[model samples]
Target: MAAVTRGSFSVLRQLLSQQYRRRCFRLQNFRSDRTLQPLIFRCDRNLQMFGSRALHTAIVSQGPIVQFKLSDIGEGIMEVTVKEWYVKEGDKVSQFDSICEVQSDKASVTITSRYDGVIKKLYYDVDATALVGKPLVDIETESSSEVIQEEDVVETPAMAREEHTHQEIKGHKTQATPAVRRLAMENNIKLSEVVGTGKDGRILKEDILNYLARQTGAILPPTPFQEIQTPGPAPAPAAAAAATARPVSTPATKPPPTTPKPVFIGKDITEPLKGFSKAMVKTMTAALKIPHFGYCDEVDLSRLVAVRAELRSVAEARGVKLSYMPFFIKAASLGLLQFPILNASVDEGCQNITYKASHNIGLAMDTSQGLLVPNVKNVQLLSVMEIAQELNRLQALGAAGQLGTGELSGGTFTLSNIGSIGGTYTKPVILPPEVAIGALGKIQILPRFDANDQVVRAHIMNVSWSADHRIIDGATMCRFSNLWKEYLENPASMMLDLK
Candidate 1:
């Protein structure tokens, strides 16, 4: 009876196995595609359902460390020179506080802190070249938004405010451009003691010179500016802002900017491309990728010159500096209205043109640094006097290496006024992304026959253009130049079109 029962159990197990195999075969036959491969390997059933236990990754919660990278600092520039550091490692900084100063070949930009936190590390030193989109500085802050909320509710204590005031005193320097500071130092004058006549009580070189002139007959200093030297580490902020403020971990070991290596050419000494010139060369070399053509023409600016002379007193009253550049910028902007395609850029494939809405005309100004083409926004809406003021401001900032990135951005069209330095005609390089660039040559007093066939001395200015041949044809470029000339030559006609 026991043997019979064992046989029956073995038969039932075989039948159950047969049924399972039949179901699997049916399921395989009903499959839609042959893309499903035969299982040559198999994982454990437990692992197939839920992944391997030993392979689990543990999530580690950490506070946020934010990093600020250089981006479009010089309007699509690749790298920048680290000019000066305002904050050092381990120092607490609030949002929007000045962190460091970077010098582009075109201008100097003050980088601000992006977050309120303690600076963990500074990635580069002054005079160092930092690539765009690379790490600059790191700051450690709370990962949660609650910390920011808490900070907003908390008011700074009176003692803390007093301490900050004392620190400012220790810094003991006015916010002046590097040029002004250098002039003051050369005169052995402390900037703190100088009375500022500039905007926001900022000290200018003129202020320092005036103060020194009052003290003595001339602006020259009796003694040179002395340096306070210490053998070891210095803790407090120096009067010149010589060192980075407060080091939490490592104190900043920044050496003074080195003197550029000079090249001796027989009797004269010339320096190689150092700061801004180096940048200009690099950018211009890159701009060679564009297939550009040159256009040359002459414009009679007699009427425009007369108009400027008449407005000279009005400009002086309004505290605006009047120059030929303002007229050129305005005329170019208005001419751009007739030929909007000139104020545009071509697509990468040379397939499309992007017309700009605002006529942000860039003026190429010669500076202590190489030529900088800082643009003025909405040139159409501004009067010539207003444009002159903007030009003056940009030139001043460019000289001091204090021009912001905004001043260097949004340039739809460019004007090169090399005429100021006495050039007759020059095919200026096109500042890329923009299809067209116009250069004004020196205005020559030429004796020419008028419409009445009488010879007269006319203020004739030669203008040269460089336009991308891919987007702008020779005829279109010439027409645009003629339109620009008409605005300057016949100043009366533009009055009816002024919007």
Candidate 2:
């Protein structure tokens, strides 16, 4: 028989007699299962243990703390910079709810929670690089079912006693999300000493903001945390890191370290690279991949200007605004139809030229969030008025930093209106995959010789073209520019090429 040590809780045991058959025993107070407590029993052989205790105490928790790893959001994106956090620590979240927003080199993406649970912890702060496959946040979710293998169910008497022993479990550690911790770290606040008002005394982001408001002499009087707001030794490690980085050594000997200069000697304020600026760096680098050369010339836009003035009233009657850009876009599209090679791309191997069928002209719009070139697709099919309307839409989206999906691509050619912002001319860089890009300068009145012989003040605009030497030669680029100039000089020809 097994050693049946009496427990405080009644035991419903099952036993077998050698002479007879199996029998079952029942006791009072053993009606339902105890949720908070784990079932305990003495180790026995020749018999099995089974009961209503559906969960193991060792693994059973309020919920399982799962480390949410950052998966491949893009094509082999090695890391992503955290933009904003939607959920904080201790906040209950549901499956498919957005947890945070991250920006990669190509685009911005929102991260969603995979499990329904309360946020346990966040590993990285905003603007910090979160590496692929690394934990982004921890979610404590209730696990409905768990599997316990045969080998996993058994344990030694010593092990069973250690886990089953009654003891007080204290959660004195500061419970806060990564964003809250970042705020505290940035403000030099001590999280450990600040009292939390969250579940199980969890420190929330709101608590930190409240603490800051108090420090600024707000209506909320100083709380207990105010007493512990003195500068602590947390910054000592950073100071040590700075000291370690100063010394330099040579193959023979190293120079003795000296007192370092203050970092704030000249600088007043600084900020990290955000998405807008970061995108510029990445795109500009991509733009420089091909060997680019430029062509500069002035075009006679007098005829086109007259045409625009004639149509300006008509555009106004239709509640639409017309500008010189529409004329430029029209002339460029028609010129591209003549010189299709200018609207072509070099294959990946640089062996073949892929001429695009549609003339999607990218108009570079200067925005607060860097240069955005949202193209007007199928420009060859749209009239001058329609081109103006498309430009209006694209410019609006660029200004709002709301360029829609695929609006920035499918561009067979790009035109940068640098002259609109008061530049004589600029050697604009060619956007990737496009063979050539054009620069439109501010229109100015310049003295030029007329058909007879006398110099006359003419409406002239400087045009510069940057072409990829890989495919487009200087001769082809000059010919393309002259064709564009012809359309502008003879505005009637641009209309003739319509449709």
Candidate 3:
């Protein structure tokens, strides 16, 4: 009798289950059943009422927020500091409008807006460091409803966490700050290849620096890590009370070494380095690592001086300011034709040398900002007059701090006219990759013995050269210098090579 009763109850339960499933199936096809459409809508509306109205309707009519990230402004630039901003929050901006100015290790970069929008937020302040690929500002831009709906669908925290987990599982995302990623990119090191030691397996800047130090056998700052606590589920009140009673142990972290601040003896003003001055510091640090071969000599510039004076009138009529730099640069190009090795660059491994096809001679100028070496592109193809015109343009631009990255890079050789600022001889540092650099001193009127062995007044200029001793031997540098000097001494000879 008990078995019969149990079987009857099981049969009734199965029938009720079937009925519930049929009702669910009809509701799932509510669009086909017009009678249930209003009921389903009413249920949806009731559920939405429990949710925040602002969360759903707040951004429905408004435009989407766009993040303006910093891009690669120059080669090998890892980070830049915000210098100034032209727009602020709530300001309306048009496409291609000036947004802000930033200073990198290479040059000053002007950022412009890519979209027409209102500035919603600024991520960085003046003098704050901003990493490449990081957001510099937030802009509110107009968009279509379809795009807005798509954004809203994925706006939940659960959806975001799921997407992040998916990327992590697929190994498509790297856990790192933008600065760390940039450093890895600059060194050609893959972030996945290095072991991270930060929270939740994130890579820090110190990790990259330490990895590099290990590879190069360099002594770097010590790495200090704090104690990491694993998260767990909450316990009952009684268990939590017992856990709280127990003493917690924390690992000690070593403090980083600090340098002693300098004490001033008198009135001292502190100034921060930025832009060109900051770039020069980094450049000089790297340049000093290469072995330099030095060569010094004096050239009789009396003939060249007279030739320049004769050409001044012609240059002025053409609305060009002709200087000795054009003749000096043209002569160097001619010398490069005879000895191409002086115009070549060597790899860090010293296994290969690149002989450049173009003579992109760089001319160093001292402006109010700092020292700038803007080069004259394809000096080999340009005439002396053309070189002079380009030189004038670079100087003008440098003075106004408006020189572009292209104007400042790809120099095959460099020339510094220390004479303009008053110097007899200067040991110019070789701008790396480039094998040689030359410095010209002020021209002085001095007596010298000519071929007749009689003392005569002549315009003599002292020149000093520095070259990469690893690739350029002393003999090679001297030979190149002599050839360069011959053209400057006999200004008429450069005309033979001048096409």
Q: Candidate 1 vs candidate 2: which has greater TM-score? A: 2
Q: Give the local distance difference test score of model 1.
A: 0.69
Q: 1 or 3: which has the higher lDDT?
A: 3
Q: For each candidate, what is the lDDT?
A: 0.69, 0.68, 0.74
- What is the per-residue lDDT of model 3 for residues 74-129, given as tens digits with 9 covering 90 to 100? 36676887888989999998654668887776666666565667899999989998
Taking all chains together, each candidate's TM-score versus the true structure is 0.56, 0.57, 0.64
Q: Candidate 2: worst 10 consecutive residues by lDDT?
A: 222-231
lDDT digits (tens) for residues 135-220 of candidate 2:
88887876543411211222222232221111001111245666877888799875633445786456788888876664443433
Judge candidate 3 at residue 300 and give its lDDT. Answer: 91
After aligning candidate 3 to the native by TM-score, how far in Å is the CA of 358 from where it should be?
1.7
RMSD of candidate 3 to true structure, Å: 24.8
lDDT preference between candidates 2 and 3, better one: 3
Candidate 3 Cα misplacement greater than 4 A, ranges: 1-61, 143-275, 449-456
Residue-wise lDDT of candidate 1 within 1-499, one digit each (tens)? 9999999999999999999999999888878545444451355678654654444422123345766555443244678788789999999887546778766665565565546778898999878888866778877764465654543332223222211111111112255676877787688765544545676445677777776664442312211111212122245557336444534332244575699899776786665564567877876885788888998999988888788778866765555556678778888888888899898987667787899998999988776556778898788777665677667666656655445545666799998878767788887888878888988887777889999999998888898999988878999988888888888898887787776
Displacement of the residue 170 alpha carbon in candidate 1, Å = 23
